[model samples]
Target: MALFSIQDICKSYPGVQAAQNVSFEIDEGEIVGFLGKNGAGKSTIIRILAGVEQPDSGTISMYEAPCTFTMAKQAADAGIAVVHQELNDVPLLTVAENMAMGLGYPKKAGILDRRALNARARAALAELHMDVDPNALVGELSVAERRMVMIARALLTDAKLIVLDEPTASLTEREIEELFAVIKRLKSQDVSFLYVSHRLKEITELCDRSLVMRDGHLVADVQMKEIDEDALVALIAGKRKESLTSKRAERTFGDEVLRVEGLDPFYRGSPFDLHVAAGEILGLAGLGGAGRTETIRQILGANPNLGVTCTLNGRNVQITSPKQAWDCGIGLVPEDRRNEGALLNFPITHNITLSSLKLRRSRNWLPFPSTGKEAREAEHQITTLNLKTPSAEESLANLSGGNQQKAILARSLSAGCKVLILDEPTHGVDVDAKTEIYSQIMRLAASGCAIILISSELPELIELADRFMVLSEGKLVASLNGEVSENELLKLCLTANSEMVA
Candidate 1:
């Protein structure tokens, strides 16, 4: 018998049919990959299965028995656990307390037993081969570490079915390997898993079978061995070829468009100099904390005023603030879009026009919400980018992971920016969306928009960058153009930090 199954489930929200007759099943000891565009009912189905939300119609069964659950607690008692895309740890609480939420304190006095709680949390971490301190504040952890805590929480519950939504979204290679090892062990223990991810390579590696969803419909359910990346993409996108966006044109660089001279950030570091030419795609490659994002932020005036100076279009400029950088025709798509780029509560239509709302305002400097010009532009963006939202007026947070990313890119491009900086544009986006975004970036570069791309994925930089630079410990260590390889880039990033230490 199937472990758990949803049959012809349907759900609808105001102005959106979030899910329509969506159905899938998991088997014992199987890792099933769930693939879909953002807002294509992935979260809705997960919510229904987790008993966080009820479907408008249809039935769910557990072990061939009809089951009705109205709360997450009930689902947990039924051996189901869900790790959401965002961590739910309490910032003020220690790792142990946050991990043990809802479970009573191990003492009769009602005062928390810190030692026992710490020991349990430590044991969970040790099972995953992690060495984090259980007493550490949840807020003090990195994104990757916080995710590990979440996984540990689920493991402690001893749930039979685990749903992981973008589990490795913020994880490094080693962390991901550790997670896979844990998953493999659980599979052997007859604990089924529903793995949702945007990375196709990982899906193939980790999943036994895969299901693809589109616009709330289960489009395909097949074994992982039967599909290649291209076939999988076409299955999701509905065609092998589409006219939405194409690859960028190859072009020669013009004179220096941006120059950084003796740029010293807030930390103690040696000064460095680098230059970007007109229409050039400058790739900044480095490990997680090698200062690639910091360097770009400093150039775009998002960071504190660095001691060094920079030049834009041959004119010496002081970019002390983000507004100053904008005035100088520089735009940045920050690394953390959820925190820096999009307002989660706002509608897509509003967010798309936010950066350029000033352009549409009258002399009195008041926005005209009813003008419909911004609405038309939003629609244009939706069509041009092939965003899969019900409408632009829908809340941005309602969209799926990939569509939310597209909306962010649309907002950035709407600014009419000259020197554009895209940091990890494809982060958490699905394969179809990744290809579409790459094509869009290339087109932007071909239009004389000097581009600076900061990415940890070496193949991306190697594929799109005209010239690549490596940052190590807040300094530019190697800048190479033409015939660059991923091996060279990784080596530079690894050595850069140690070089600074020396």
Candidate 2:
């Protein structure tokens, strides 16, 4: 008998049929890949399995016994644990407290035993080789560390199956390797995993069998060894899509539109100088903590203390704040879309026109937001970006992750930016969404917008970037033009104290 099984699961939300007769099974000690595009019923099924949502008609069986799970606690009692894409830890609490949540705290005679709790948290984290302090607040930990805590918490449960949703979206390459090692160790002990991710490479490397979903149905179930990356992409995308490398072509460059110099002095490294021409996409390549994000922050005036010189369109500009950067025709689609990009509570119209509210005003004298104009602009953006929404008035939180990302991109472009900075634009989106984003970016570049693309995926950078600037330990180590291989980029990212090139 299979360890866990879902048969004929059906779920619907308002006008959307999220899942339709979905069925799958995971054998004991197997890591199954759950592959699908955004809004393709993957999240719906996962939620149903976790008991966060109930299916209209379905049967879930564990160990060949029919199970009924109406709440998260019930699911947990049934030996099911889930680590969602959006973290569930309380930010104000310490690591130990967050881990002990839902699970009772260690207590003696109705008193909380702090020492015991800390010891347990430490033991749990140590199992994953996570070097986090139990007393450290969850808000203070980095994204990768926080993820480790979530995984550790899952392991602490009496769960036979763990569902990991986009577990490596925020992890660095080294951190990802460590996570894989931990997963392998758990699998040895007979823990099954339902690994959901948009990254085909991760699926290929880790999963034993792959299940593909599209349009609220299970489309394909194939053995890992029987399929390649191209086949996987085709399965998720419905039809065979062109390779990302096929989109590469000879890009035309224009006059210098943005320049950065002398940021390294504040970062305590060699001097940094760079220039981006109009209609050009400059790729910034580096590993985590390699100064790529810092460089972009300095250019956007997000790091005010960083003494950096910037020039726009041959004119020296002093950008001391994000507002100043916006006024200078610069906009950044930040890496953390949940925290920095979109207001989840707001409607799509508000998010799309948020950065350019001044342009939506009816008149200068009144100085009030014009709802009609905002809606019109939002509609245009929705059409242009292919944002899937019922209407502009729909809440941003209601849309899928890919649509939310596109809405954020619309906000960046709505301000009439001349130099657009996209940091991991397609970080959590699926293959189809990624292709759409790439096409939109290419169009933006062709229309005289200078773009700075920063991505941890070296293959994506190698395919899209016209020129590459590699950062290592807060320093610019290499600058190369034309096509480059992923191995060369990874080498540059790992190398320290390389000679700086102009």
Candidate 3:
């Protein structure tokens, strides 16, 4: 008998079927990969399983005995826990407190047991080889650290079936290996995992079998060894697709568009100098806390003016804030889209026009945005990017994770930025969406838009970037001109960080 099972699950929204007749089961100690494109009903099915949403009609069973969950707590009681792709963390709370959210507070003598909470949370983090302080505020942790914190919180529970959605979208090579080791160790104790990720490589590495969904339907289910990554892509896409690496072209670039000097004082050698050309894709490679995102943040003027000299298009400019960076023709698609990029309550029109509100005005002198102009501009980007949304009036929160990411990218496009910085731009998106995004990036580069891309996936860099800059602990370690193997790049980054830690 299967350990946990859901049969004929169905769900629907206003205009989307969401999920249709989805059926799957997980055996004891099994790790099943739930593979699907964004909005393909995977999230819906997971939500129903987590008891966040009730299926229109279906049966859930454990050990062949039927059960139903009407609330998230019910699912928790039944040993079902979900770590969603979009993190559910309280920024103001400490790491231990966040980890204790649903696990219940430890109490002794009618008072909160703070020491017990920290000890438990610290143990969980250590299992994943994370070095985060349990008493540190969640908001102060790096994005990768926050991701690990969420995973650790889920582990703190005594879950029988743990569903990890894009669990490694932010982790580095070292962290991912540590997590996989922990998962394998847990599996020996009969723990089951529903591993969800867009990185097919992880699916191949960690999952025993796979379930593929497309257009709200569970289209294919197969053993991992029986199907290759290309076949998996074909199944999820509902059509055969060319290999992404085959799309690579010769390195090309125009004039240098941006230049920076003295950004990092850690280098005792020559002063750190960085530059990206008008039509170049510069891939910034690093481990977590490796200063990949921080470098870009400094360029965008998020930190204090730290003796960092920046020159844009051959002219020196001072960027004092993110808005100032955008005003000066630099647009950023942040790594954490849910919290940093999107306005969940706002319409797609407003969100898309956020960075380039001036472009949506009826006239150049208009102080207020023109509604018609904004709608038209937003619609253009929606169509151009193939953003799957009901309408421009739809709230950004309502769309799937990939569509929300696309909308944020559209905002950068609307800004008509001269230099664009994409930090994990395709973090949680689907494979087809990844291809489209890659195409759009190449098109932008061809159109003379200087791109500084930060991707955790080394293959993406190998496939699209004209060059690569590896960072380790706020220091420049290596710079590869082109065509570097994934293992080689990973080794370069890992070796640097390992040496730094020592």
CA lDDT, every prediction?
0.80, 0.85, 0.85
Model 1's alpha-carbon lDDT is 0.80
Model 2: per-residue Cα lDDT over 212-278, one tens digit each: 9887899999999999999889888888877653565667889999998887723675677878999
Global local distance difference test of model 2: 0.85
> Residue 493 of model 3: what lDDT?
87
Candidate 3 residue 109 Cα shift, in angstroms, is: 1.3
Deviation from native of the Cα of residue 445 in model 3, angstroms:
1.2
Clashes, model 1: 2
Position 24, candidate 3: lDDT = 91
Residue-wise lDDT of candidate 1 within 62-151, one digit each (tens)? Answer: 897888879888888888889887566797898888888855556637776788889899999988788889989988876668888998
Model 3 segments beyond 4 Å from truth?
245-252, 265-271, 361-373, 497-502
Clashing pairs in 3: none
Ranking by TM-score: 3, 2, 1
- Residue-wise C-alpha lDDT for candidate 3, range 320-424, written one tens digit per residue: 798898878888898887788889999999999988877777888979889898889899888877787778999998888778888888888667789999998
Best candidate (score: TM-score): 3
